[model samples]
Target chain A: MDPSEVEFLAEKEVVKIIPNFSLDKIYLIGGDLGPFNPGLPVDVPVWLALNLKQRQKCRILPPEWMDVDKLEDVREMERKEESFTPPPSPYYMELTKLLLNHASDNIPKADEIRTLVKDIWDTRIAKLRLSADSFISQQEAHAKLDNLTLMEINTTRSFLLDSLNCMFKLRSNMQPGSGTGKALDY
Target chain B: MDSQSYLPVPPGVGMEENFLSLDDILLSHERLPSRTECLFPRLGYLEKTSDSQDIMEGTKMELPLWLAKGLYERKRRVVSVELPKVYREGWRTVFSADPTVVDLHKMGPYYYGLGSQMLHFDSPENPEIAQALLQTFIGRFRRTMDSSQNAYNEDTSALVDRLDCLERVLFRMGQSGLNSFQGWEKGRASHLTTSALVLNYRKRKMADLQA
Candidate 1:
């Protein structure tokens, strides 16, 4: 077999495997974006493409997985993202929506989130900074981790889930409102 | 009792003549001394005949209580006790007690006003007196310096230096007094003034030390 054909077949196999695996199970294999044959199989690239066929569906349907919008919409969307989102009880689709919107805007909600996390992280960092011996003990580490703010940790957890969902939704050829949703396994 | 008998007696007949001519009789006449003669023998005729004439020669002396107390207080040994009040009272009691000891012409203004003088300043003639005054001043200064808490650490060096300078000046004054002035009469005023100036400098130095 030709090396290029083998490579292409491997990529196809990886794409096939993406839908069967849950979002959490599908690792980002390589490159800045993800495991790729140029782009994800469905929603993300189609949503990203500027051409009319791709652009029209994105504008009309606005995939639940696609996050980016026009440059003018960026600031307003970022402001919405920063405004407080109360975590849903037992974590629901609405909480995922909030996290997806925040991550999609790509407007350093991480830094804002990090700042929010700082109060939780500060005592740990201070102890680390002061500790004469370089490494933190396991008990100290666990104590610090336990002390992390619920809202901050929750937001981070939701963001991770949203990212995984995007990867899954993109790879699996899932369209918006498609009811293949298996209870958002992990 | 007769008017004619009262006339001046014959040269040797009257009692006055008898008393003068009868010196031996008069000497024998006083078996007991006369009351007036015994009380004030110096004032009476006994002064003329007293064997030790020098004992009755000069004026009598008695000291009033205030003068005695003032002298006792103003004594050199007692000056430490007196000096504070003396300084406070403008050295008036000190001057009154020993006007000769401390020359008023030089030290007068510190105690009293300069009167009508154009240039009013302290005068000291003896350097010893000046040094004594300086010592007293430094003593008071040290007392104040010890009690005071303000900037004591910072002022310590400057205070010590100024005190040293004061001592040097006082010593110089003393040396000059000894070298130039012989009698208290010439230098008394200058000595007194110098002493007062030393005291004033000491006060200023003390205030600085306190600060």
Candidate 2:
């Protein structure tokens, strides 16, 4: 699929999962301040979908017009900033755990679960645009559970685990050091 | 020598009706100095009652004179200030010359000033009259409760309970007073009449908001 098409699909996927998600903003990190270099790897925008606590849960997207074959070179560009430990992607870690847990249960409601996860991600993205202060720790994320009704608590837990599992599986499928490679080891 | 052996009435000491009308009771010079004095008799009455009871019962309940004077003066001022706005123009025009009289009309809305008499008045002999006096207190308590925004809080709940107790005491007094005179009915009728005034105030506020 075209990189733009993939980004668009990913954005849609995020909204489909999380209710009350807005798509006006996405966070981007690590890129050269020059013209697009088709010869060398182009930069990618790291999309972190977050919940109210700003805990993120989505994969990074390559810059516009970049081909998949250039995915290897794109990964190298990201590695330069990899040393800084781009604040543990609360987005990826959370969503991946949720999806993985859901998939393990062999639940038929995986699609429903995915939708809520996406809604949360989209909300996070919208919040980031409105607020740079995105990303919350697990403790803060769990604290949010207190505010949820009893029913929401149970459903959200399962949904979160399922999303996390799916992200992990997607990471394993992609080649190492590829554009959509595994998130930071931590 | 038994108290129960005594006849209902000693023929010579007949009970004379002191049938004071609302105007007579409130405006009488015999019990009070005048209309202005009647507006704040609770201040002096409380002092005298406290001192006499202290001497007879061997316990001082009388507040210090300075404090008593300060409280009475403050209460009088509050009543004098509010009475004019609350009372009809005609009622106030009568006492317009006397600033103290005008003050009484101005502070009429704060009937709680008289209601505060519960803080000091403690005559066990006139328990019936004392209970009737509590009606003014209960009225003030209810007004304060309804006017406050956060009446649901713990502190407010305690205050409300105290107010309710005062109301119950007043109701008991009303029941007892009914045996003597039909006048208690008129006083009871006027208790919640101020609610209409408050409702009108609220409507005006809403109109102002829309404007």
Candidate 3:
């Protein structure tokens, strides 16, 4: 899938925003939005939050996990673990990029948070590659991808799947008649 | 990614060849060393080295893989296909020692495809040959994966120099995945873009006008 499409999915994640203008409770398809009062925080999807923040109609409250200290802890835990640790959020990478890019004014230590998140991402990708290599080398039939975020998986999906397919075909060549007789593989 | 009119058929890496795959077609054309088991009455023109009207029995000649495959039989050998030099014991040892060092592009560009096809002919070392083919791929896979994924927005001719045709396909897949993700990270993928088909169509019209 396209990275932009993944980003679009991330936009559905809700965030807290404080509006400067009062609006009567707006009802819509997904759910009721809110009676957004000036200086009062209301939960809204990232798409609407970014739109309101862009119009100078609201102040975006960065997610609780977006703090630099918390991310530093997550980064440390990620480096110490061999397997994937649960991510801060399913769309952490996308949310971090979007929020920091659009609402850095409200997010304290935005630059530091960006760097920490990037470090965590790099660490996770390295572990992912390492595990993939072992999985191929051992010729294992299946693997569970626990705690891997969509953005992370999207980066390596094509390469990993293609290699696995090639390896399977090459391995099947070992049996004299198996290559042709194995109609079930398709 | 470059715009293609249609998806090209992928090479079948094992014994069965894809009928429409361009790679498989070229692979079938690769010459194999063979010896005629019986005499040919009027097919002497095929043997350019001799002036005889009939090809003598046991006449050694090179035959394309398709022709060799058709004539070869177990019970009565009309023709005998020899193992290609690269798949013989000497090269098999080299591959077993370390597959990553050898240049498969210079060797059989269709290394995996042809190697699998070689299995059709009965030989004492058939098992060894198959083992070596699988091992060679397994040994060289890591380098192919790493180089393809890491080399972004740069000339990849050097990176792909030693890769076999099959490995090259894997490399291209890796590159596309990496390129798309990198483009999105730089905030470039969100913009509205013209389809590559439309852009190429414009170029085609310009070429027609010039002609």
Candidate 4:
């Protein structure tokens, strides 16, 4: 899966925005959104929020956990633990990128948050690679991918699956009669 | 994942060869050292070393794997296939000791494929050979995985130079995964790009047109 595809999925996640102009509650197929009032925050999908932000329609309220102090805590927890801890949000990486890229002005300590997220990402990726190596070396049939995000899985999916497939084929070769019988039948 | 102009039929990396696979076809052409258990009359031309009208019984010579496989049968025993040096005890020890050191491109490029195919012939060393192949793969896998996943946005020719064809395929798989993720992380995946098929497809040159 593409990261953009994952980001597109993430765009469906709801975020808070305060629109300057007043508008009545708008109904959509997904759900009812926004009885926008000046200085009053309303819940809307991230795609809509970004669009509104771009047009100078509203000020996006970064998610509760988007703050640097919280992220720094998350990073510390992530580094201390051997396995993954629960992420701040399922779409933390995507949301960080989208919010920072489009509306850095609204997000306080944007640079610090960016660096912390990157550090967290680098640590997680390193753990992911280490686990993948052990998985391959030990010849584990299946592994439970706890706390791994879709984007994280997407990066290693092809490589891991292909390696497993290759390993399976090579392992299957150990029993000569299995393939030999099939060969004679052919 | 990137799409190619054609979906290549992957090699039948087993004792059984896939008929349509180009790798299997090429593998079939690999020569095997063999000794004939029976005579081949008027087929001495097949053996350039012999001037006789008929190939004598018990004569030893090299034959392509396809020809050898066809001529060999356990019950009839028309020919006997010898284990390749790579599959013998000496090389097996070398492989088992450290698989990463040996450059597989210089050895059997189809090391695993050919090794699997070797089992078709009845030989005392079949079990050992099979074990060696599996062990070698398991041992070399970490290196292949590390290099494939880590070497991003760089010239990979050095990393790829030592890999066998099967490992090369796995390496490319890893590379594509890494590259796609890196591209996405760099915020380029959102941008529209031309399909590789369209990019590679173009009109022939004037020289070709004239020819």
Candidates 1 and 2 compared by lDDT, better number = 2
Clash pairs (backbone) in predicted model 3? none
- For chain B alone, what TM-score does every candidate structure achieve against the true structure? 0.16, 0.18, 0.93, 0.93
TM-score, each model? 0.12, 0.16, 0.94, 0.94
- Output the chain A TM-score of model 1: 0.18
| Candidate 4 displacement at residue B157 in angstroms | 0.5
lDDT of 3 by residue, B11-74 (tens): 9888888989999999999999999999889998978999999999999999999888778777
Q: What are the per-residue Cα lDDT tens digits for candidate 3 across A57-87?
A: 9999999999988899999999998899999
The 10-residue segment of model 2 chain B with minimum total lDDT is B9-18
User: Please, what are the lDDT tens digits per residue for candidate 4 over residues B181-205?
Assistant: 7887788888899988888899889
Q: Rank the candidates by lDDT, best first.
A: 3, 4, 2, 1
DockQ of 2: 0.00
Task: Name the regions of candidate 2 deviating beyond 4 angstroms.
Answer: A1-55, A58-186, B1-129, B139-147, B150-211
Which is the better candidate, 3 or 4, if ranked by DockQ? 4
Q: What level of docking quality does candidate 4 show? A: medium
TM-score ranking, high to low = 3, 4, 2, 1
Which ranges in model 1 have alpha carbons more than 4 Å from their true place?
A1-35, A38-108, A129-186, B1-211
lDDT per model, in order? Answer: 0.26, 0.27, 0.89, 0.88
For residues B15-134, what per-residue lDDT tens digits would candidate 2 score against the true structure? 111233232223212111111222333344454545332233222243321233223342333111121122234532443333222232234322222222222222232233222223
